[model samples]
Target: MEKMILNYKEEELIGKIASVDTGTAIAFIPDDKKMSELQINQLIAVNSPRAGTHIIGMVVKMSRRLDETILQNDIDDKKNDDNVVLPSNAIKLVFVGELRDKEGIKVNVFKRNVTALPNIQSSCFRIDGDKLTKLMECISTIAANAVTPLSLGKYFIDENSTAYIDGDKLFQRHAAIVGSTGSGKSYCVAKLIEQMAELKSVNAVLFDIHGEYSDESFKRDGITQLKIAAPNDLETANKLDKGILMVPYWLLNYEEMQALLLDRSDSNAPNQAMQLSKQIMTAKKSIVKGTEYESKITLDSPIAYDLNAVLQELHKLDTAKEQGARGEKAGPFNGKLTRFNQRLENKMSDKRVGFMFSLTNEEQELDWLQKFCRQLMGTSKFNNGGIKVIDFSEVPSDILPLVIGLVARIIFSVQQWSAKEKRHPIALLCDEAHLYVEQNESIDAVSAIGLKSFERIAKEGRKYGVSLVIISQRPCEVNKTVLSQCNNFISLRLTNVEDQNTIKRLLPDNLGNIADNLALLDIGEAIVVGDATLLPSRIKVEEPKIKPQSNTVQFWQVWGKNDSTQDLDTAVENIIKQSKSE
Candidate 1:
């Protein structure tokens, strides 16, 4: 009732349903009304069998066809006009939902399903102006009743209508934000960040693949910014206080170590792996020789052990001489461990991956895990360390998958181990997820090892209180498994045919053709659909007060300028140092 009631008047009549089906109906507009008044995606309220309800639908297609019967007056002018055609205009309406009256309830409600379909000849009217506003308001009001409703932008159907979605469903069941390179993907993320920052308790880690988020605006009062150790940070990164994050190699499991160090092509790969595992187990045992952990320490345990000792043992086994019946022959693994040794030694010596091997004495201590997890996943009421934006720009691409996977595994593992009742839920905002979450049977060993962690999270993270927000510019390249698990999508302008089809295939069968609008969307405009939204809508994203550093550089404007303030020396020095430019 109230203002939500669709008080249809005879003066507003546009058409009558001529055909009805399971999920759609064809309405024949009267010849007196112009087809120009109808538009694609225009909301329609068709008369229903129920007393106080109407079948809500949108005009998906329209056509003007010639009537079969010849007009009596036009029959006389048959020679003047061929066949004397009388055109009839009709529209195809796909039923979306239903609008029900208050019936004594405090407010009218719009359910996603209709109780009855409109029969043939039912009058249909255009839902515009007041009716459109009221209908959109009903959906918004339903979400507004939630504890954490997310306000993204205004509906394109009605600019006056502010769009909202269920924030809990958006994250709890996972979500994805996909678009072209400059299609405001980052702006949407920054908008979400700005909104989440206003809440009392928010715990999330945004993996900043590039250093774009290093700007001051992203460094809000409650957020912490951290960077992976670079070649230059080796000498200075002894602690985690000043934002240098060290994920020591000891945190990696056995298979991860094999993927990182062992050469799979080598014939001695299996033996080399077995010996490496044995050496690691021995090293781990030394740390807890006098404690109960000694018996339970496995090669896969997350315990700080002497990697140098493992190396020495592998070398000994590599060149070991056997005590044969004669003088001395070769040992079982004399030369099998040579390639493994070389790879480990080289990676350990490389300063680029110092974050994994170059840990200080303090970091090697048993209590380091407590401090590390606390700083990254802490839920302090003051929000000092609740939100973290970890920058991995300086990390080498060769090992990017390994390092990123390591960090994600750490977060998920910690949450998995925590008691369910005491779990402090966290969101993993995986920026540029396509890099590590690749979709192919031919990915390399490192990427495969890395992909497993994310796939597991996509499959089972919800039960453990972990949510993933996958943000990428290319949906075609991102793995479908992870993308399919997402229950919500905020899709922006996508021009590529493959990328558009990727999204089209994922949409519900009824909404499949909606992807046709993907290429036509303007910048900052997106189609929002999922369990979070009561109605799939096209919205214009609101401009965030604090925007990300993803603005496209005005190349032409910069080129015309006569400014020579650019520093060549600093750029050369940064490249030489294998670090980010200041």
Candidate 2:
């Protein structure tokens, strides 16, 4: 026997179907009484032409007009005694899913596919109150039954029922969580992190661009806080013990090094790149002298080498003179490497990017790469299911993209080279992704390199056990290719027309009406639809127990206070020091 998905009483009937399309149907109410209480987005069901199936849809548009019969007759004398209006009302709904009578072991099964359209004059019933709640509960059961279920919050359709998005599906394919500023993008991210923290084993690294997620609130396991080594750290001695990470210049491949040091507009750019490449190979080869790598080392090999040695070699080329037919003549490369040498020297001395040039005793060893990658990729460090928050707050803005790319590339490359059995899955929660992954690819070469690294992850990271959680405030500005690759979307309020359109394009054509409601979403509320979610709908995302620090300040309230003060001297000193730490 098949169970009824929605048990409705005789009085609950709203109308009868008037017309049908490929995936939509129109139903006209028999009277104005039924039309008065109807609302947009209200779920409704209609009898399908196929036996043992019902089509589920949402009220998209409601219209009422004068009945045709009333206009046919008019009498002046009758008008003086009584005035009455006859109205015809109808509602347009797009089919979202269908309820089946029986499917294998499941009875009254609900699916996102409509196998058949509703029949003409089919009775339409409004899904409300108890029926709505039970239907929502059934969806919850589907999520709860998943192999790796992830509870997000309660469904807005029925607050009493909990909402769960399939976690396995969410990460297996890429996913995106986008909204306008203060739309709770951070709140939703925190909820995901809080859940990951409580699990037996979870692995993810959040790129904290604005330093908002550095707090250790989710203590189910420890959360390691890491900061890119800043200028102040150079004077203070950069150390891993304090969670300050130093990415020595030797770690940069030949191309990345050029992006940081080469001036693209310089006429001598080609020569400089060649010289830098040659010197890097020479410097790296010195470390592997008489070893197996001596014959196999490449210029891009991430081996800790002496940049000072490379500097000396470039200086020799800049000033060297060779015997010529006449007298002493410039060497084959004399003066050609001058500009390149100066640029490299300037970057090495610039304290703002000291992280990339500062190489400590421990960082100079051959095993340093392995140690660093382990620290970054190993999420279960010390038996804690802790998330690593990589803070790029102190990194200089101009080179921030390159630095982020450097880290992302390291993790990705290491995973790609690892044995299949040894490789573990890792998700990058990219906060403020728009700053790095831009739709327009020509602005910053440094950022462009970074964008490619991420794009590769979006395209083929699944096979390498890598996934991305692209978090952004401006969906329109993000790379369309990367955003399109996301199979799951948890979108908060997006008021901008372009951003809304961007999301609309990512969704199926039938769900365009749902995308239209992006502007109407409340804070902490989101429209979740994709592979991870079974029923596409809105949900008030559960408040994370450990909230991130990305909160909007109460500017008006602060201005009204009389006790506010500023330490100008201290502020200036911190700015000069390029750090907030005392």
Identify the candidate with maximal TM-score: 1
> Candidate 1 on 475-552: residue-level lDDT in tens?
888888999999899999999999999998888766765677899999899999888898889999999877778899
lDDT (0-100) at residue 442 of candidate 1?
A: 91
TM-score of 2: 0.92
Q: Give candidate 1 misplaced runs (Cα > 4 Å).
A: 1-3, 32-34, 66-88, 380-385
Could you give me the TM-score of model 1 versus the true structure? 0.93
TM-score for each model: 0.93, 0.92
Writing each residue's lDDT as its tens digit, candidate 2 over 353-401 gives 8888866677788887776776677767643444788889888888887
* Model 2, CA-based lDDT: 0.81
Model 2 residue runs over 4 Å out of place are 1-3, 9-11, 66-88, 216-222, 235-238, 382-384
Cα displacement (Å) at residue 155, model 1: 1.0
Per candidate, the number of residue pairs that clash is 0, 0
